[model samples]
Each structure stands twice: as structure tokens, then as C-alpha cells.
Target: MKFLLTSGGIMNKSIHDALVGMLGKPIADCNALCIPTAMYGHPWVGPGVKAWEFISGKEENPMVNLGWKSVGVLELTALPSIDENRWKPLIQETDVLLVSGGDALYLCHWMRQSGMADLLLSLNAVYVGMSAGSMVMAPNIGEYFVGWTPPDGSDVTLGLVDFSIFPHLDHEMLPGNTLAAAQRWASGMRGPAYAMDDQTAIKVIDGVVEVVSEGHWKLFKP
Candidate 1:
């Protein structure tokens, strides 16, 4: 699987270009599925208008709003009740998966429960993740970002990537997300980590990772 991990969803031309490059086609020609499960788990974002906005392409993030050939919702929380045969093929056939931001641990839980986590490694489609969506790919989100804890009550995530991520770095609205805060977060990670602004994204294809940014980012290594 290919990854286009962003703090914000394709917020800038560089990130957009990286996504297009990964697709190997124009956005208008591809079919997409937007996963809005994470939003429901977040206290500040869910069970209301916010989820509707993300699905309807009314959110500030440039995700579902992208002109795709088709866009469908793949709510992870609801997948357990349905038959796998009904949804597995749909995922395999989709060109990309647009994942929304919320609680990383919550998203990780559903991803596991829904079997999306297992299926992801075998897919050929691109994955576009925003904020928590991106962080869920890391080995761990660190204690600072933990919310909606799993059964084991650990900060661990999917570990799809080798490094962790500190998203929305220094955003005016999230004053606690300063570089210093990210550095402190990284110290606890005990591994490689990235601090990225909204205009930045990390691209991973065939195990090679590259930073695609129009804003600022820093990489901290243990």
C-alpha cells in the first residue's frame, strides 16, 4: 500500500501533487472511500454536524471534496455487523481511501475490529490520512495524544510506519502543539518522529519515505 500522510488533508499544491503522483492518475478518474469512523470517537468532533461536513465535503480539509470519480462512506464501526464478502471487494476495487482525523487510538481500534488493518497491507490502493488518520500508522502516538483508549489501554497504534508523527505543529488554534511540545512528545517515543505543520505531508511508497511540504517540518531521531 502507498501512503500520503498529512496533518491537514492535501492542504497545499505540493501535497496534492504528491497524492496525484501516487495515484498515477488525476483525482477525477479515481474512485474513493472516505472513512469517518474516527470522528465519531472524538468528543469534540463527533455524532453531529462535523461528521456530516466531512462526508459531504463541507469540512475545511480538502479530502472528500476532491473531485473523484465516486466517493462513498466506509464507516468502520458498522463493518463488524456485516459480512466481509460484502465489503472486502469494495475496498480492493477502490483507488484510494480518504481517512479523517479524530482520536488515533479510537481509529486504531475500529480498524482492527473492522479487519481494515489486516486488509490494508495487501491492497494496491493509496491511503490518504489526515491528522489522527496519519498518526494511526505509527508504532505509537505517545501518551500526550492518547484519547479513546483501547481494551489494553496502551498508546500503541498500527505500526505501519517506522516513525511516529506530531501533527498540526504550531497551529494558532492548537497552541499546545508547538515545536517544543512536539520535541517533548518525541522524547517519550524513543524512536524516530516527525513534527509537521498543516501544509506538510509524508509520502511513503514501496518502503521509501519522503517529506512533501510547502510549510515546515522537523525529524527527530532517538
Candidate 2:
């Protein structure tokens, strides 16, 4: 039940420390599994093999610096279809699961179909979700931004957490994700929503939620 959800992966010392602390062991002793499946959602261009190259070439990816004994990158979507059993053992052996960002809907597709979403609570490891990774864990993803929409006509609730997370708040790269947009999005929400910038993260452990950040964030309530 340890979750470290961030906009950008480990952007500061606070987030890094929080993640390590959640592990409850020296980070050097732990291992991780990186799932970059979200990168293939809508706007998923090019051949499928190109997507694999992008993930495999992340030798300098940020997930490597968190002090894990090893950070293994495995594109969930690339795995053989209908074979969660083949990868369940690998997932169980890891100390952390780092979900990469791209498109929330795309990520949700692989997680739900792969049965990874159901195995989450039972795993004895930390779940680190960045951007889209954070959104897919919500009970329901309301209309929040221009992209990252859930499937058409489907509630598609992962039910992993009670609230939805709007990541990359005030981030310069995404002009549509301004504070005003977040307010507007939250205004229509059925429940609470959390907005976080790259330097921020929301930590949830055993139902107790905590804000861990080195930048700005907001908790929007309905």
C-alpha cells in the first residue's frame, strides 16, 4: 500500500527521500520494474518497434538514480498478450514498480487488460506513478485536460484511490495545464482532485494521504 505518485520522476531530494522512506529499507538493497506502457496511447505514432526503442534507450532515465540495486525496464504492452502469469513472477520479485508517463488512457488499457491493476494491492512493493501513471489509479478520471481522456462511454475506474490526480500543474511544457484550467477541471469533479507540478508528489500509504513536494500543489474539493 505504498504509493509515491509524481508529475516528473524524482525531481528533488524531498521526493527521492519520500520514496526511499516508503521502501522502509536502504534503497540500495531494492530493485525496480519500469513500465513505460503509457507512451503508446493516443497520438501513438510510428511502428511499435520504435516505441520499444524509446524505452530501451533510456539508459539515462531518471528512475535509475533512486538508488535501487537495479531498475529493469519492461514495457507492459510489449509483453506477450494474455500472459500475466509469465511476468507475474518478475513483478513479484521487484521492490518497486515505476510507471512512466504519456497517456493515461493508454496506460490504463495495458494495466487493466494485463491484470496488473488487480495485482497492485497484493504486491509487497512501492508503486511510483509519474504523470499519467498517477491518473490511472483514480476511482474515476473526470474531464480534466485536453488529452489523457478515459475510454469513450466507459466509467473505466481503476478504483485504486478515491481521488484523481492532475499532474504537471503550471508546467511550462503544457500550456493547457495552467492553474485556471485545473480550477475549472476541479470545479466539475465529483470528489477531491490533487494538482501537482514536476517537483511535487502525493504519497498514499494504507489510506493515509500525504503531500510531499518541493514545489507548488493544490487540493481541489467539490
Most accurate candidate by lDDT? 1
Q: Estimate the TM-score for candidate 2.
A: 0.87
Q: Locate the minimum summed-lDDT window of 10 residues in model 1.
A: 38-47
Task: State the C-alpha lDDT per candidate.
Answer: 0.95, 0.77
lDDT of 2: 0.77
Error of 2 at 37 (Å): 0.4
Task: Give me the candidate number with maximum TM-score.
Answer: 1
Off by over 4 Å in 2: 42-61, 78-82, 146-152
How far in Å is the alpha carbon of 65 misplaced in model 1?
0.6
Task: Give the clashing pairs for model 1.
Answer: none
lDDT score, candidate 1, position 43: 97
lDDT of 2 by residue, 1-222 (tens): 688888887888899889889998888899888777886774642236535543454433356555678878766666646476678888888999888776777677778777777788999989988777778888666655335555565545576888888888987768998889888878877788988898998899998999998899999987
All predictions: root-mean-square deviation over Cα? 0.6, 2.8
